[model samples]
Structures are given as structure tokens and as C-alpha cells.
Target: MSRRLRLLVTTVGLAALAWLLLASIERAIALAERFEGLPQGVRWLVGGVLLLLVSLGAAVTVWWLRPRRPRAPVTAPDRTSLEARIAQLRHDDAGVEELRSELTELDRRRASARTYLAVFGEISTGKSSLIAAMVPGAAPASDARGGTTREVTHYETSAWGDGWTIADVPGSAEAGGEARERLARAEALRAHAVVYVCAGDLTRSQAEELRWLGDFGKPLVLAVNKADQWTDIERDQILQHVREQADGIPDAVLAISAGGEERFTRRLADGSTEDVTRRRPAQWQPLRDALRRLLAAGPSALEAQRENAVLASLHERTGERERAYRADEAERIVSRYARRAIVGAMAAVAPGSDLVIQGALAASMVRALASLHDVRVTDVEVDNLLRQVRMTLRTGTSVVLAVAGNALKAFPGLGTLGGGVLHAFAYALIFDSFGRALAATLAERQALDQADAGERMRELLNEVDASRLRRLADLTGEALRLRHEPSD
Candidate 1:
């Protein structure tokens, strides 16, 4: 009921209650006067009973008229429900599917008992010889010249009954080697631990490659092969240099000879001793021991590394998809608000009315943008943003357009239409730029502050192209014109 009607009813009811109370008091007085000649004790008992009944009635009325508490609001849905709703809106099915595939692969890898230890290095780094030595009777061909191995070669064996695979990657120094390098890195990413073999001091590129492999957070062992080829001092210098260059990589660095030739004494048939030179078997026992210790660190460590790699890949893929989605959504928002601004401009009847209508339209656009991006903004913040925009326009190209539009309004005939079109185009451009800037800021999950938002708006306006604005205005005009045509 209306407030006035409720007050009227309350007043009438109160007056009736007062009248009844007065009548009851009058009757009680009359009764007391009639009982004045009776015994004093009997009259007192009757008065007490009447007083108790009146008090009980007054208490009941007060209880009935008291206010009630309001009902609680409905509860919100759970997080999973909210996430499902967001997914539906975002429509990121492809990214989600790719993530599912990666996770499934990770689970499969975890179920396997084999531990892969990939050997990564430049060409002619003895990676092949090292693998051959690590696995007896599994010698792979090698050459003195670099780029001998053109593909990834895997040697499978068992160490102390635990299955292991040693992968030898082709030298990454060939012409058009970027593709091969990428493939090698991909192989390294899948390895539980890495063994990087180099015959000499690490080059700048080699150091960078080592660092890149270590970025996957796997255990790495740097083996300086051909240790017997250099003097003791030179070997120490190489080790120290590699350690300095590689920084945190190489859980342990060992000196070993995988292909160094050695001289041995031979007895001739003519009772004379002769010296014979031959390629010695690879002596990589220290390197093997280091690798064994790394693998023995337990399955938990390996699983953790695998999980990190998979999660990192998933994060990157999902991040790319989210960025693309946000960009597309932002463009749609700008186009939508630009069209709305154009409509408001076309309806302008006076020069001053253009400013008021455009300002209100921009405010509405800002509100819609905040809602779409899930940004929390207050009316005061929105008003501040609009004020900044107006201040900026007053001293820029928009001012020139505003003056031209007003001058066009002074003429007759086609002048009015020209003026409205100019006004509409100018407002449309301004709202479009503002919407894009707001979208970008919200995409970064930032609060809408006046100073930063104003700066972004000004930057976007400065970067605006005349041709693009003209095209947008033309498209909007064409759309509006088409809508006004009579149906067939």
C-alpha cells in the first residue's frame, strides 16, 4: 500500500481503539460505583481481575503489531558451476582438448618404468661413443668430422636391473640446423635427466644451449669427453671454464675419454718389441656412476620434474588461447559500442546536445565493458573517466571536428545531415578507442583508475588512422540506412 493510505488506516484504527478504551474505563467506573456499598474485600478482588484482563489484552496487541525479520537471500552456485559457465561463454574447446591430450600423455609416461637420459651436445662431441660405451656391444658409428649423426639414436639397456635408454642427438651445427635443434630440444624435454658431453671448453652458443635444456628443471650432468687428449692443467681449466659458463647446470662434471686413441707395447715375431697404436675403449665409468646416482634419487624426484614440464606447457598453451579470446572479445565490444555511439550521434538535434548524448553513451559503454570483463567499478570511477575523456577531447583533434560540425549546423538544406554525420562519426571514433583501451586494461586484470585509463585513451587516440575511422563510419551509416528502408 501507499505510505499515505497506510498512515490513514493506522490513524483511524488508533482513534477507534482510544474510543473503546474510554468506554471500558467508563463502564469500570460505573461498576465500581454500583459495588461501593458491597464489602470492601469483594470489590477489591473484582477490580484486580478486570485490571489483569486489560493488561493481557494490551500485551497481545503489542506482540501482534511487532515487525518481522526479512528472509535471507538465495545462495550462489559452487565454484565448479561458475567455472563451467565461464567455459561455455569463452568457448575455448580446442585449447582444453589439447591440454587433455598432453595430460593423458603425461599419465602414460608416468606409468612406464624406463628412465630416459638424453645426451645433448654439438656435432663430434662423442655423444655416440659415450652411448656405445654406456651400453656394451651396442657401438654406433661415429666420425671425426662434425654432424656425423644426423638423427636421434636410442640405446636401450638395463643398469642394476632398472631399465634405461640413452639417446644420442645429432650434432646441432649443420646448415639449416634450426629444425634439428628444435627437435633435439623436444627430445631433451622428455628425458628424465640429461648428460651433456663436450670435448673442449664450451662455446657461447653451447653454454646457451645447456642453459636452455636446464630450464626444464631436469637433472643434468656435464661430461668433458677426451679428457686424456689435454694436459692436466688444460683439463682443469676446461672444467672450470665450463662450470663458470654453464652456471647452475651439470649436477656433476666428470672427465672421461670416449674415443681417445692409446699406444700399447707389442712383441714382434722376430724377438723384437714394437709399439702399436689403437683406439681405446671408452672410459666413462665416472660419468656412468654420476648418472646412476641421479637416477637413484628416487621416482618421486623424476615424477616431480615430469609434472613441472607438463604443467609449464599447459600454462603456455592456455595463456595463448586466453589472450586470443580476449583480443577477439575486445574487438567485438568496441564495434558494438561504436555502433551505439553512431546512433546517438545521428539523433542529435543541436550542437550542445551532441556532447551530452555522447557523454552518456560513453558512460554506458564503459559499464558494459566492465561487466563483460568482470571488472568491479563504481559510478564515481566511471564519472571520473568520462571527465578525463572530455578534458582530453577539448584540446585535441576532436575539438576541431566539434567546431566543424557546429559550423555545418548553421547552414540549411544538406548542411543538417552533414553536421549530424560529422557528429556521429566523431563520437563513434571516440567511443571505439575508449572501449578498446578499457578492454585492454581489464584483460590485464587491473582496476580502472582515472590516470592510467586517461593515458591509455590518449595513446590510442594518437595512434588512430583517418582511413580506419572513415571506413567504420561508412559501415555504420550503411547499416543504419539499410534498417530504415521499407520492407518488400
Candidate 2:
């Protein structure tokens, strides 16, 4: 259906559901006296029918509004097709060499980069101050007031040589979908170490978060906040909670008070430093020790010493080969056919066409692409393919917000210069759409070259905290390698 019609149906369906629910309640109230006199069997039928209709209507309405996708499972790939694609990728000999070279350079950089350290703790605690103390020019710690720190901040660390970064993610107790997605993306794309932070509350919520972090399969560290003023009773409860939560993860918790000016400047005798060690209570010493232990020995430090020697060699041979595979499928095979399928969808816009011609355009586009590629285009894929193309086009191509701004100011008409302005925008869109489709098709597999190394590196990093690791990624060649630099 057209977008307008689909929206209309949705509005109508919602109205219908509300009407049904309200009507059912009213009918039952009206029949209250009669209901008491009627046999139980008839009353059951009336109530059951009302509920069933409402449930069915709600389900359909939900399904209608959800984004559609091709029926294919996102994770599945048939071996035979994969093999065929791989076999074909061998032809791009020169481009493969260039890709290999780039991969080698990146690997060399990553392997030697200084690791980052993160200071994580929940609201009103002092993660901000902890980082601030470790790095000069860092912001002073402040009370969160509530679950406020909505933005993730980064601070450079003195301990992780140079080229290391520490990222502080916003803390949330009841994290929803966006929170999960943001954290997961940060975990996948950036976090070098994982610090599960919690504050004053020694309740079950902290236990739940800490418990899940245990299984994240990283070098887990717990940052229990506000230890300075913990009563003996609260202290014991907090320690017990920490011990139980850290179970299975062979790591220790860090304790430091980022609040108060004195604690903010507290320095340890060991090579390590604290943002607010002097101001917090004594229990935090053990946590600082745990943070120290993480950097003491591991493959991560060894890899940094050697740089990217092994991975570089591997990429020099395999890098470009992967990109060629994606290019073949997307540019030559998938997108070429996809455009044809989309043009076919235009048939629906033709006035007074037959029902099949008008309605099947959307369905036909999905089926045609799958058939041409000799692949199964699942229902989910059907819904998302065009949308994916459109989304990619919007981002991969420059938006030229400047042009959009001008057009809005003019506010041209349907048949006037305004019309011409719309045409210009339309032209820009067409160029962007076709360009993105072609480019994404070509580069879809480009990331495959780094996927393994990225995962391996992230695994090592996640064993720690993101704040510190990001420092490593963001620095220049020289700053990332020095280990003895004095830290906060």
C-alpha cells in the first residue's frame, strides 16, 4: 500500500481498538443487572468475544506499524554461495594488495598503542573526578544530582603510556533499548576494558548489573562508590554484595572517592594514582590494587611491545581480497538488480492500474531481487531492503544542509521556481541514492578484513575499561608507548 494509505489504516485500526475496548466496558455495565440474572454460559461468550477481538486488533495494528524486512535471518549465510563469492574475489589482484597494505598499517598501530583505563561508577559517586585526578586539565568531580551524566566523556591517562584514552559511559539503572544499543555499540566498536560501575545504593539493582557484567567475558572491574561515609553496617553489606557480584570473573574491584577536594588529590605510593584517594575511606585501597593488577601482565601489553607485526603480515596477503567479494555482490550483482526492481515499483503510481499491478509492486521488488540472485529473500528482508538503501544514501552522501536551508527559505510552489527548487533537491537525492547503492554494494565486505583483529583487540580491551583504551586509539605514534609517565 502507499505510505499515506498505510498510515490511514493504522489510525483507523487504533481508533477501532479504543472503540472496541470502550464499547465492551460500556456493554457490560449496561447489562450489569441482566448479567447477574443471565446464565454463566452466555456471559462468558460475550466477554470472551470482546477480549478476542481486541487482542486480534491490537496484534494486527502492531504488526502493521513495525519496520518490515526481508524474511532472511540476519545471521544466516549458505556455505555454497559464500564459497562461490570467495572464489570470485581472487580476480581483484591489485586492489587486494592495497587493502592488505592498509590493514597492515592499522594492525601495526593498534598492536603497539597504549591501553586505556576507565573509571566507572554510578551517579553521585565520583567517576568524573577519578579520571580528572589521573589526567591533568580534567574536570573536577561533581555530584550527579541524580542519574544525569547523559554524555560519555573521555579523558587521557598518564599511566597508559601515550595514545591511550579512557571513556566514561553514562550510568543508568533501568537501561532500556537505546541504552542497551548505545552501550553494546560502544562495547563492540570502542571499549578496551569493561568497568561495571555502581554507587551508594547497595540494593539488588547493583547486584543485577554487576552479575551481568561478570559474564561479559572481559577483565571486569567493579567501582563501588561513596565508600568514605559508609557505616559499618553499610560497609559489610557493600563488601558482601561486591564479592557475590564479582564471582566467576577473576578480577578485583577498585575503591576510590572522587568526591571532596582532598581525596581528589590523593596519590598512591605505588606507580598508580587516584583521582580522589585521599578523601575516600580506606576500603578503596584494594580496588586501586585491582586496577593496578590488570596492567601488570597480559597479551595486551606484549602485543603493544611488538606492535602489529603478525597481523600486518596476514593482512598484506588477505585484505583486499575481502573487499572485492562485497563489491562483486553489491555493485555488480545485488544493486544492479535492485534498481530494476525499484523502478518496477513505480508501476503502482500509475493511475487506474489493475489491482495486481498497483498492489504487487512492493512485493514484486523483493521477490525479483531474490529470484535474480538465486537467494531466498525472507519477509524481513522484503521490508528493510529499500529502507536500508535509502538510509545509507542519506548518510553516505553529504546532506548539504545548506541547500536544504535555502530551499526552505524560498518555499517555492508546485509549478513555480519553488517547483524547480524541489526538482534540484530531487536531483541531488537521485545522485546520492544511486551513488550510495553502488558504493555500499562495493564496500559491504570491506570491514571483514579487520573484523577478526578488531574482535581480538576489543576482547583484550574490554577486559579493562573504555575510558583508558580510547586514549590509546586517539593518540599519535609517540605518546602511546611511554609507560613511566607520571599519572594523576
- Pick the lDDT winner: 1
Candidate 2 per-residue lDDT, tens place, 1-488, comes to: 79999999999999999999999999978888787777899889978998999999999999987764422212223334433443445555664443334344435435646554444444445656555555647542331212223455655555544555566655544346466334432321233455555664445755654544433334557766666667777777876766655553536654445554553555688967767444432335565567567655643654432222223323323435654454454444433332333333232232112223323443453354344334555666544544443443344323323333343344333214333233333332232233333344324432212233223322332233343222222221112123226776
lDDT of 1 by residue, 1-488 (tens): 89999999999999999999999999989987888977889889978998999999999999977664332222334334433433544545655554455555566666766677789888888887777677767644332113324566666677544766677776777678887876576557667888888878888888877766666676889999998778898989988887777775668987898864569899989999989898776778888789778888655568767566546544555557666766787788788778877776676664234566577767887887787667888999888888777777766665546544443344333244566676666666677667878887877756786777777777766664556655565655665676578989
- Segments of candidate 2 deviating more than 4 angstroms: 1-112, 136-152, 159-164, 173-189, 200-216, 245-250, 261-284, 298-366, 369-488
Instruction: Report the C-alpha displacement of residue 252, candidate 2, in angstroms.
Output: 1.9
Q: Give the whole-model CA lDDT for all candidates, comma-separated.
A: 0.70, 0.45
Alpha-carbon deviation at 265 in model 2, angstroms: 24
Error of 1 at 428 (Å): 3.0
Model 2 score (lDDT): 0.45
TM-scores, one per candidate: 0.62, 0.36
Instruction: Write down the TM-score for model 2.
Output: 0.36
